[model samples]
Target: MYFSRLTFNPLVSHQQLAQTLLQDTYREHQALWQLFDTDPNAARDFLYRQVLEQGRIKYYVLSEREPVDRSGMWLVDVPKPYDPKLVEGQRLFFTLRANPVVTVATAEGKKLRHDVVMNAKKQMGFDALPPADRLPLQQIVQDSCVPWLQARAESNGFSLEPEWVTVDGYQQHESFAKQQKRPVRYSTVDFQGILTVTDPVRFRTALFSGIGKAKAFGCGLLLVKRV
Candidate 1:
């Protein structure tokens, strides 16, 4: 596997392209797709997280192959090979932006993935409550999304205490696809904390394969470092 950072080049003079990337998630996905288009029929096999630092747009990407930028708009960092060496009880500081959802069986026996934060709001009748009576958005995010990450950690070969993690940046993204009839929609939550590896093998898999959903639109890349 390889890890790389792609940063927009202000010297490239691509204002329109930058605007499109900033305003349209689907466009950004398509732009990133160009980096890994070794095969026209290849499926997506990478995870990315888009971030803004010092007013510059940047992307952190993990992929099975090195990313090549044919476009001049980005300054692509040299791709570094990644093979995590982990052990049981190893603790690392981590940051993950995930599309956290819970599968629920509908009354009609259909299974649907619902965004945990939105589900919590509905279950608590948040909309019905007056504005003054509503809980702070961050509190609601922490209350709902933390548990979702906790549940994911249990199965992903790591463990985290609620107090050790900070969850926020709840956001819903909506976009239109030219080839699709329905609008695309998803929610993301940011999690940052220290985690202990209970199973190094499993944790390594998670690091490569990602966690949760929406790997295409910059959602499930887990960035970590030694504490």
Candidate 2:
């Protein structure tokens, strides 16, 4: 895998255009494929995350091969290979922007949905109680997202240090596909912490495959650094 960063230049266009590139699903998907020289149909191997750092629009991407610089709206750095040798018990610090959701059975049948935190609260019977008896949203999210992440790590070749994990920046995004014209809604949560590599092979797969849904729309990219 190769890693790259693209920073949008507001001087080339309005900030709205840059923001649209980050939010509009179809536009961003098409824009990402432009980084490669091959046909759009063949350029399907990549994961990207859009982030705002120090008031700048930046995107971090991981791809199977080096990317070609093809856009004037943004500046792309030379892509670097991310193929790392792995071993058991290696500790690292990581951050992930993921769409955390759960599958639930509804009247229509099984559906994958967001708000794992809300469901946790409901399981505690908070919805049936008075407002004052309910837990704060932050507390509920912290309680719920940790276990959810832990479950993901168990199969993904990592074990998160419970004491070091922190969850914040919870948000929901609504987008539409150009062809479908129907609204698509998803929620995102940011996770940061230290983790031990438990299964090298599975962990490598997790690194390349990403963590959750909406991977195309800037979610589920796990960015990590050796600690």
Candidate 3:
């Protein structure tokens, strides 16, 4: 796999393109798509995360093959040992930006998807009425998203230390896709945790496949480092 960072140009129009990368579901990197033998539209074998640093937009991407690029973007590829073996009981510090959501069957015999933190708040009986005083909803976000992540870890070949897991940078995102008529809405949760690997293969799978939804819109990328 190849890990890369692409820095955006400083122009306003170029910065707008950066925002397009952040919000859009269908990516437009033709060079990245060319890396595949089969149709990239069909394969879709890549993941990415975008962030801002020093007022500049940057993208971190992982793919099965190295990507090609042209002018107007500074690209760097990170080199790593090929197929490094993983073992059980190894510990690592990890960060993930994910869309944590739950699907519920409604009274109309339909299913609705909800942000996990908001769902937690509702389950805690906060939905009947609004709080009179100003409240930091993000605090409730941490409380709600932690257990959801913990449950995911349990089945994904790792276990998180209850005291070590943290959730922050909670925010909602809404966007329109070219293929869809309506807008798509979701919430993003940033999680940082120390995890112990119980199953190496499963852990690797989770690292590549990601943890939750809205991956195409910059959610569900799990980055890890050795402790």
Candidate 4:
């Protein structure tokens, strides 16, 4: 069960973007380096080849030590070049494939979908990036899809890291509200959702419960748990 934000931006080229964005996010991303197995660069190479190729990467944009932008995606055409000497001994570069969970719903309420979208913010090894506003163009891939990636990671019990090519959670986040340019000021994105299980058998049960019963209503991504 993973959530992902989707988008398309025709601007990306700073090859170092991927390394810059995720460098600081390692703890939350590739946390259990030992417990999860392998050394540092083991996981970094995966993301560099997978996510960055599509110009997609995940991050929690911060401001003054507070999270200002919850999470979002940026899509662009340019690519962040892979650099091994920047940090760990991993070599990184761009690719041309899409990651899962990318969508294209307008702010009004629409669902444009795709299999995999380009990611631009990928780099080899690891290192810290610049501040948000000061973030360079190479670091600005238009389609990020961080939410879905993150959600998938949480459900899988493996954190996201540059080491892995395809991250479980890319765009999943703490909000059901429309993706925003920045985080909400007052009220937060309403995460009130339904934890539902649906299969051929469960659909029979859903048939019994009317739509107005609050059991089955919203038509967003449905997280299905086996238990």
Query: Candidates ranked by lDDT, best first?
Result: 1, 2, 3, 4
> In model 2, which residue pairs have backbone atoms overlapping below 3 Å?
none
Instruction: Using lDDT as the measure, name the better of candidate 2 and candidate 3.
Output: 2
1 versus 2: better lDDT goes to: 1
Q: Assess candidate 3 and give its lDDT.
A: 0.73
**Each prediction's whole-model lDDT (CA):** 0.87, 0.82, 0.73, 0.27
Error of 2 at 165 (Å): 0.5
Q: What value of lDDT does candidate 4 attain over all alpha carbons?
A: 0.27
Among these predicted structures, which one has the highest TM-score?
Answer: 1
Q: Looking at candidate 2, what is the lDDT of residue 81?
A: 80
Instruction: Name the candidate that leads on lDDT.
Output: 1
lDDT of 1 by residue, 139-175 (tens): 9889998888888887789999678899978899986
Q: Indicate the residue-level lDDT of 115 in model 4.
A: 32
Q: In each prediction, how many residue pairs overlap at the backbone (N, C-alpha, C within less than 3 A)?
A: 0, 0, 0, 56
Clashing residue pairs, backbone N/CA/C < 3 A, model 1: none
